[model samples]
Target chain A: MAIIDLNNVSKSYVSGFLMRKKKAVSNISFKVGNGEILGIIGANGAGKSTIIKMIQGFIRPDKGDILIDNNKPFDPASRIKMGYLPENPYFYTNLTAVELLRFSTSASGMPKQLADKRIKTLLETVDLYPHRKQRLKTYSKGMTQRAGICFALVHDPQVVVLDEPMSGLDPLGRKMVLDLILDLKAQGKTILFCSHILNDVERVCDRVAVMDKGHLRKVFTREDLGNQTMEEVFLHTIEERSEC
Target chain B: MLNKVLSLSILTFLEGVRDRAIFGIGLFALAMMSVTLVVLGFFMRELDKVAVDINLSAISLAGLLVTFFLSINLMAKDIDKRTIYCVMSKPFSRAQYVWGKYIGILFIISTAFAVLTFCSSLTIVIAKMQYTNWFKAFSWIEYFKAVYASFLMFVVLNAFIIFFSSITSSSFLTLLFSICTYIAGQTIEEVVIYLKSANGQEAQLSEFIQKMIDILQYILPNLSVFDLKVQASHAIHLPLDYLLAITGYAAIYSGILMIAASLMFSRRELP
Candidate 1:
């Protein structure tokens, strides 16, 4: 069964100061099935983050429907079962990693005992146990991103959405994040991610969605994507869309 | 759902604690309050003259510094630091996020008021020594009224900033609007005084301005109403009916501003 669905959804934003109208995502639609890792690739301003924001309900779209496991995705209640890691995640810099995780748990309403256990295990899972008590302001970019992932998974939600999760990292840090995604997949979790790093997405995603000009350009599994690179596939699809 | 709001409030409180800049701000505010003692000790003959003015003025000034300047800048710091997006993405509603932030910032303002009031009253004690019996403390009741009044003033000010911060993309506009609110709130009495006087040219203009001002006087939160410094300094007795009515007015005004702020926040989009 599909775990995530966007049917005929559209979003437009009116610029606050300029009063200019912008159609961020126009009639966009796709799905991610249970236990599937779907990767989305697009350039900046391609409505990648806008779609994520809509799915997270930070901003409601103007029209159509979005369902997470057949439930309203934009409702606050549906968020309890979903975990999202934003690109360039922000933290209370003065807080220790442990404290941030604890704060997230309290806000998410996870039981205190379970919250503690999860924090402990997740810190170790991310290899952040050594810096758990250090202030986040002192952490490097990679370390902060790791802490971001830890907070996202603190509730052990059924669906995990990560936007550019591996962007700010060295090779080893990227490897660690890629391994984390695989680990989550191994445990039967449904993962949705968007990336500019095509190689990273190619290695982990079971299926891939390419978005361009506020629409889904194509959906392909690893085999259909094949040894042909993401750029070549993206080029072919954009050319097809333009011609049609 | 409400539990999330409560928990976020606590987190907001803790986040304020973590800022550490507020501690330095508190100390500076308290220092000014204590400086009044030095000035009062220098002019021991006019002790009561200085004590009443200094103590009451210190509360408003300290509260103005914190609530006017600090509260307006608080959200700016979170935005500059990009920490706002994380909080917004949680299961928390925008109303909860904004109210939590407002309440947390208010906690800091209240603390600043308390410390400043304490230091100011201590000056009152030392200054009142020469005026009254040997080394006897004058009275805390008057100072208590000042503190309570200042607390209300800060709440309105905090709400004012939070409301503007929601709709304004520019911190400069937000700060300017807060200052305008402050000036408008302070001049309401003078505006009313000019309203009733019978004159020809100026009065016609004044009355038109006065009518508009009268509408603003009730519509905006009145900083002057919460200001009991007149009685505190002049040792004049304030009417109980007027004071209570003003407090009730503040409560209603603050509620409307906060509800409007919540509505604006609900429609905000985060990057």
Candidate 2:
């Protein structure tokens, strides 16, 4: 069974006094199977994050259905096995990195001893252990991103969703995050990530989902790569969808 | 659910404490309290009244600053910064978020009041020592009661802030709405009393004006009910039933506001 599923989900946002309606995601549908690493690739404003939001139950779909663990996204139980890291995530600046991790782990119902142990390990893994005592406000952008990653994974969720996880990271940080994603994949965890970096997606994703102008243009597997790279396929699909 | 709410509440409280505005307001309140020393000297026979009035007003003004600056900023920051996306993605409902934030702001306000009231009480004590004979009628119990009521009033005001934060997209608009609520809430009872007296005297209240006052009395909080400062300052005996009734009023009104905030926030979409 798919751990994350969206069947014809659509969302529109109204703006301004005139209530001008803008379609954000249109009839978007996909499924992330257990232990599958799926990457969503899109340009800016291509509705990648919107799909993640729906899967995480942050927003309701205007039409169609969304299911996590075979339950509606609106159900808290449906999110029991899910973890999410938003783009450029900001945490409570007053909290140390460890404190934020503790909060996250506790929210997931981890007992004190177990949560503390996991927090120690995760901070070490992300190379933030040395600075975990410092408030999040004092951390650099890359450090904050790493903390956000730790926050998402602290609960040891079976399905992880990350939006633009590599956007603000340096070369080394990007490499570290990519290795972490690969590590999670090896652990048999299902991962769904949104990114603009085609190479990183190709490296870690079992399948790639392309979005263009709020529409799912194509879903490509490793076998479908053939001689064409993800960038080429991505551009072609977007151009084809635009022409249509 | 309780765990989530508690965690969020703790985080919110910590964040509020770290904010420079709280420190700034704390200092501002202390400075205002010190001014009572100078202001008290200006009055001869009513030194106790001046001290009580200044001290209570300082606490009230401090509460306003925390509500308008710290509490509003906390709620609005989460949304405007999109940090709420991280929070909302957890196993929490919108109502949980609202309750957690409201409780956290209450904690900040309560702590601020505790400290300020302590300082204010000390000020009153120092003044009492200087004029031992004149402060014969002063009651510490009454003064504390006034502070408690003032705290309850701010609790209701913070609820209004939460409701506004849930509905409005911009913090500025939330601030504006909350301030307007505060202004209207503070004066609506007085307006109602005036209109009623005018009606009794046949002094002519327009039907529209009378209707507006009636609507405002119900819509806006009757904050004046919480003003026990005059009674405290004068050492008047306050009925126990009145204090209990106002406490109940604060709880029910805040509860309703929270429910409304949760409902509105749940329906809201994040950008």
Per-residue CA lDDT of model 1 for A22-104, tens digit only, reads 88888888888999999998878788888888788777778888888776754667677788898998787767898888878
Q: How close to the true structure is residue A65 of candidate 1, measured as C-alpha lDDT?
A: 84
Question: In DockQ, how does model 1 score against the reference complex?
Answer: 0.58
Task: lDDT for model 2, please.
Answer: 0.89
lDDT of 1 at B189: 74
Model 2: lDDT of residue B102:
90
Residue-pair clashes per candidate, as listed? 0, 0
Predicted candidate 2 versus true structure: per-residue lDDT over A144-234, tens digit per residue:
9999999999999999999989977999999999999999999999999899999999999999999988999899897899999889899
Among these predictions, the greatest lDDT belongs to 2
TM-score of each: 0.90, 0.96
In terms of lDDT, model 1 sits at 0.78
Please state the interface RMSD for every predicted structure, separated by commas.
1.9, 1.3
Best by DockQ: 2
Give the Å error, residue A121, model 1: 1.6
Output the worst ten-in-a-row residue range by lDDT, candidate 2 chain A: A73-82
lDDT of 1 by residue, B1-271 (tens): 6677776666666666566666766677667667766776577364665677776776677677666556765675565555776776567777887887887787777667767766777767766664574224334565577567767877787788888988876677788898898898888776667765556334555556767877776776668877777665545555677657767876777778889998987877654
